[model samples]
Target: MLPRSWVAGARRPGPTPPAARRSRLYAHLFLWVMQSWLAMFYIGAGYAKLTQKHDLLALMMTWPAQVDTELLRVIGGIETALALFIVAPLMSWSLFRSVMLVGAAGLLADAGGMVVFHTLNGDIFLAAVNCVLLLMSLIILLGRWEWRDHAQLRNATS
Candidate 1:
């Protein structure tokens, strides 16, 4: 047997008490808001990549002649697809995880490429931004389990 205070602290509440329930509701709402923000960011990024015809491609073409246009196009297409996958409502948790993993990898690669470009061309600001975005993507990918739980809770509430 334990002391009365210890027992009281250890006791498990049935389901959730009213106050606890309200807190959980608020937490769920916050999670939904975060999810919406993430989804919208991905959607906007994909849109920008798809719509903008930037000089990045031209710059790439000038590099090591072995780099092909087809490869660049394929990378752009993959990024857009992954962004769409992140925002898709019907995607499974496993699929979302896979997409996040791939996106993180891509972001890391982009960061490396940006660093190299900046080192060669002396563009510190762009390289720093790319590094920051890479870190954000890695953090999101690592915390995917929490996002999965949030998604599950949201689905249950709906």
Candidate 2:
């Protein structure tokens, strides 16, 4: 059997106790905050791309040049869609957990790519920003995965 400290830290893979539940609640709360932050951030980014304003001009003017207008809009649309994905889980939509997972995964990929892109463009600061975002997305992904695993374990036992 596990040691007491180990057991307490491990918790079981079944129904959550009060302390476990509290931790889960905190995780959910963090998820909500992340979801909100990512949704707003992406939505605004996508909006800027769609409208060809703000960062659009910068995108056109800067390192990765000659990005087509329509392309920008399409990228924005995808970003906005991902933002909606994050929001759905918050609203407790039936398929939202999966959707949020997918969104987080997508953002994780995006951030990782941006990190490389920025580094290649000699924009160390931008690369660092994306690296931070990548780590943040990763934290959300892992936390959500833990929660998902517990939920599935609970269901299977039930």
Candidate 3:
């Protein structure tokens, strides 16, 4: 949601322009909303994978049969960790943003793997879902990096 100046990697030695400030505000608001949805979705899915023994089988049925419960739990752990990173922004802003960048990258990779696996398993619908998640992860990763770089530059120049 950044204006042309900020998105273009603009750097100057003074207070941010009012327009740019507004742009930054909008960007943050948008990210907060999207991240909240992602965090909530993963929280539930992770919990199910980790603890819901009865439903785990049905929910994970799409996965290849070779993936045992232990491996499913491991996947759940990874999902939980990534979810925490996305939601960290709600706790400590500085730490959350930094950790989220890393988490989003991990999620991106995971989604890619899911896509490949789903496709190989003859499930285009599942692969499509993973593809959507992959795009979302990518947006978070790129957006976080762009904002981080811009803020660091702004702080340095100021």
Please list the C-alpha lDDT of all candidates, in the order they appear: 0.57, 0.77, 0.80
Q: Write the per-residue lDDT of candidate 3 for residues 48-149, one digit (tens) a residue.
A: 788877354666665624577788888888988998898787778776778888788888998899999999989999899889888888877777676667
* Order of models, best TM-score first: 3, 2, 1
The TM-score, computed over Cα atoms with residue i paired to residue i, of candidate 2 is: 0.74
Query: Would you estimate the TM-scores of all the predictions?
Result: 0.48, 0.74, 0.78
Candidate 1 wrong stretches, greater than 4 Å: 1-72, 88-90, 145-158
What would the per-residue lDDT of candidate 1 be over residues 57-80, giving only the tens digit for each residue? Answer: 455334323345555455556656
A best-first ranking of the candidates according to their lDDT comes to 3, 2, 1
Clashing residue pairs in all predictions, respectively, total 0, 0, 0
Give candidate 1's root-mean-square deviation (CA, Å).
Answer: 8.6
Per-residue error for 151 in candidate 3, Å, reads 11
Q: State each model's C-alpha RMSD to the native.
A: 8.6, 7.1, 7.7
Q: What lDDT is reached at residue 36 by model 2?
A: 81
Better of 2 and 3 by lDDT: 3
Model 3 clashing residue pairs (backbone): none
Model 2 agreement with the true structure over 1-158: per-residue lDDT tens digits: 86666554445566668998898799888877877887788888777777766454675547325456666677788888877876777568566888888988988888898898889888898899778778877877787775667898999899
Better of 1 and 2 by TM-score: 2
